[model samples]
Target chain A: MPSLLHHPLDPASRIARLMLAEYGVPVDLEEIKPWLREAEFLEVNPAATVPVLIEGDVIVAIGPLASIHAIEDSYSPEAVAGLFPTDAAERAEMWRLFEWVAVKFNDEVTRYFIEEKIAKRDQRGSTPDTGVLRAAKANLHEHILYFNWLAATRRWLGGDTMSLADFALAAHISTLDYLGDIDWGTAADMRDWYSRIKSRPAFRTLLNDRVIALPPQKGYADLDF
Target chain B: MPSLLHHPLDPASRIARLMLAEYGVPVDLEEIKPWLREAEFLEVNPAATVPVLIEGDVIVAIGPLASIHAIEDSYSPEAVAGLFPTDAAERAEMWRLFEWVAVKFNDEVTRYFIEEKIAKRDQRGSTPDTGVLRAAKANLHEHILYFNWLAATRRWLGGDTMSLADFALAAHISTLDYLGDIDWGTAADMRDWYSRIKSRPAFRTLLNDRVIALPPQKGYADLDF
Candidate 1:
């Protein structure tokens, strides 16, 4: 059995969980606040980041990107579903969009939103700064507007076929949606896309994630909005 | 023939170049300053990132990671070399270390150093901030120390085989070295490892790369150092 060290709201962790569930691989989830840099977690990953996958004896996949790739390499070929596309060009596009969500969207939106909105309330016990939140919301609006057009144009985020790009984007958007940061009404196509993704079996684990003190916003677990 | 749009000092571009060269894939280099965000470049990659590999008609690999993966998937297996290790565990280790250099080190050292030292001087035409440079150097010291110990223990950064991890690391280190940022004397084993990489055939084109306005640091091209 594989055990995943992850945070409930971490986008990368969500992606990893979705990757596993989509491929029908069972995993034991061990929640950890990676920022805390616990001694045990640090031993497995010096970087102190989450989504570390511990599999068979002496086989550990540390960090988000590495762990995701590890799972894809192991069970993907024989699995009924794969997160990657079969075609070379489509696969390249899939990777390109994956980087967009992981690096660009992460820098511009997810990290900012988490720091200003989620981190203050949950971890630091500090007040959420409206000024920073405002700026982050503006960034989110820009990206969502772009995604709205993108979602309208394609069957999935990358192309006609669903890939890691879809799940990765959904992971980030889901986090923001949980915090009541997204304006679904304004994002028609993207909203439609999200609603479809929300109903997937892989997304069940994520939609059920609750932060105890900081509950999810309205319609987070709703199938249709 | 493949054409690569790259910036001489860009770590990701350097990594792609090294990957192609190691696999004996010749590419016509087209230098681009990504910060400019030219209309033409945006058409290919909306992110305006460098190291976009343009191959067969209609086949375009955008961004550094995507382009590297593109080259690896196409020319790798039987081209006398491959960037990935055959052993599953070793490959996992390679991806882990590759991410370390791509995400972690780039965030900590490369971006900060480039924004302060290289980008300030080259792109913005402004004086490099000594204070910011000082902080970046401190961060680099911590990472290099970690690499030094790891390099001393293994034949390569990702264990026994020379993998993408080595080139990814060399890409970033070479960039900093060109800008005269590294203290090679203190990084004994790492520097020794770098020296060996510097002599490789794939490293030749990188050594020959010259920016008209900016030359490399003292002993930058010298392998004996």
Candidate 2:
């Protein structure tokens, strides 16, 4: 079993956790404060981000993108079938969506929420900045509209089968969803898509994740959500 | 021949250009101002990022990550051999370095330089913030030290033969070098490694790049610094 150094609400960490669990790879989770730049954590990943996958004493990979490639390569391809689309074009689309959700979505929305809401709370940094949160929410609305279109049209976020693109997105959105920042009401197709994915067995662990003083929003763990 | 929608100094775009050229894949480059969010560019890449790869009449991939995968998959593996390593562990390390250079390094240093120096000039936004430039330079120093160590130890940035990790990093560092931010005197190993890479035939295109009102620093296009 690999040991994973992660933060409960970190979207990148959530993506790794979801991928590993989905592939039935058991991992031990060690929660860390990445902002603190703890020497132990920094030793494993000089970049100091997570979730870092470690096998025995050797650290394997860092961040969501590396973790995805690491997981696909290291794990049995047969077991991780649905994690990647088979068709050439679909796989290309999968990487594109994966890049968008991991980079653009996180940059415009999820990262701000985490830094303001979660990191501030943990480190006693400051009250969550209303101005920043407002801007992030506005950005979130645009992303949701785009995602809503994808959800309404594609069978899966990457097409045909649920892939890493779906997990990459779910991980980020779920964090925002937990923080009560998402207005699921306006995201009809995205909401419908979430309901289907939210009910999956791989989603079980994410539902049970509780951030010390910050409990998830009402109905966050519910299948009917 | 494919068409690459890119900007000269944009690190992501440069990475794509480097890879295509190194692999002998002829591509027609159409430079765009990504900050403009032009509808044509957005129609091709809704994320509105540069380095969008198009084949025939359809857009294939976006960003450095997608471009790397698309190139490897689409091109003959024999022609693109050195872009990836044969060893599994080395390949994993390649992705790790690729992720760090593309994401962490960009967020910390390169993007700030582009946003402040280039984008502001083009967008007619405002004068470059001295405070931001100071912080970015400080971050760049730290990154250069880390990269210097890697250059001193490894055969290449990602180990053994030159790989996409080297291109990913060179694309970024070269831009900052062009901006006259890099102190070549201080980064001995990195400078030596870069000198070797800079002299390659694939590097010729980058050497010839120029912005309207901005000429590169001394030795910017030189084979010998």
Candidate 3:
């Protein structure tokens, strides 16, 4: 079995965990606060980040390897058809949306929210910055509108087939949802899309994850949600 | 033939340009100021970002697709073996370093530097922020050290063969070098590694790219520095 060093609320960690589960690859999860920058953890991942997957002798420290692409590389498309498409054009589309959530959404929304809510508490025990939270929320709404547009047009985030695009998106959205930051009512299409991804068996562990200091929103783990 | 929408000094755009050149792919480059958010450009990429690659009907908006992977997908390994490895493990390492340069390096160093030096000029004609430039330079040195370590250990950034990892690192470094920000003396190993990459025929266009308002460094296009 592989072992993954991750944090409960980390969107990147969530993506890795979700990808592994979707691939039906069992992994032991070890929670670590990356900000602590533990010496041992640094040995495993010099970058000092979470979602460092150690599978026997192979250690994957970056997003491209620890996320969907890694699983796609390891398993055949026959076993996990929808995870990645066989066609080059579809795969290109998948990479585009996957990166949109991972890079754009993560930088504009999630990082700011995390800095205000989580990092401040851990590092300085400071109060969350209202200005930062407001900016993040505004940015979040813009991204949600984009997601709503995609959901209204396509069957899944990438295309007709469910792919890494959906997982990358759900991972980030789920983390925000855990903080009760998302207003599902804002976009009915986005809500429907999230509901479909949230109900997946691969998402069960993430739904069960409990951050002791910050409890999840009421509907976070609800299947009907 | 393909077309690339890009800005001269944009690191992401540079990566796409270099990768396409490396693959022996012909592309018509269209320079665009992404911040202007042109309606037609946004139609192809809602993000309104540069480095959008258009081949036939396919439009790749994000960096991951428009850069190295896009070229890799279009061409075969037999035609361009070293750009992307055929082996899974080597490919994983290739993706790791590629992301390290694209995401971590770009975020920590390139974006701040560009904001202070380039974006401000285009937007408000404001003077560069000394504090922001100072922080970016400080962050840049740390990344240079890491690059130095990688160059000293591996034959190439990824491993024995030159891969997308080298192009990604070179892309960011070249942009910084164009601004005369990088101290080549500080990291001899990184300097040597960069020299090797710079001398390549694929790097010719980037070396010749002169941002009209910002002149290149004295030794910007020099092969033997």
What's the CA RMSD for each of the models? 1.6, 1.7, 1.9
| DockQ of model 3 vs. true complex | 0.49
Error of 1 at B41 (Å): 1.2
What tier of docking accuracy does candidate 2 attain?
medium
**What's the TM for chain B in candidate 1?**
0.95
**TM-score of chain A by itself in each prediction:** 0.94, 0.96, 0.93
True contacts kept of each: 0.57, 0.51, 0.32
Model 1 regions more than 4 Å off: A77-81, A121-125, B56-59, B79-81, B122-125
Every model's TM-score: 0.96, 0.96, 0.95
Interface RMSD of the predictions, in order shown? 1.0, 1.5, 2.9
lDDT of 3 by residue, A43-135 (tens): 766777677767776675445444445666764346447577777777778877877888899889998877777767777657998988998
Candidate 2 lDDT over B115-215, as tens digits, reads: 99999996554899999999999999999999999999987998887888898899998899899999999999998899989999999999999988888
RMSD of 2: 1.7
Ranking by DockQ: 1, 2, 3
Better of 1 and 3 by DockQ: 1
Candidate 3 segments whose C-alpha is farther than 4 A from its true place: A60-67, A80-82, B56-67, B77-80
Candidate 1 vs candidate 3, lDDT winner: 1
Q: Please name the candidate that would achieve the greatest TM-score relative to the true structure.
A: 1
Compared with the real two-chain complex, what DockQ does model 2 have? 0.63
Lowest lDDT 10-residue stretch of candidate 2 chain B: B75-84
DockQ of each: 0.73, 0.63, 0.49
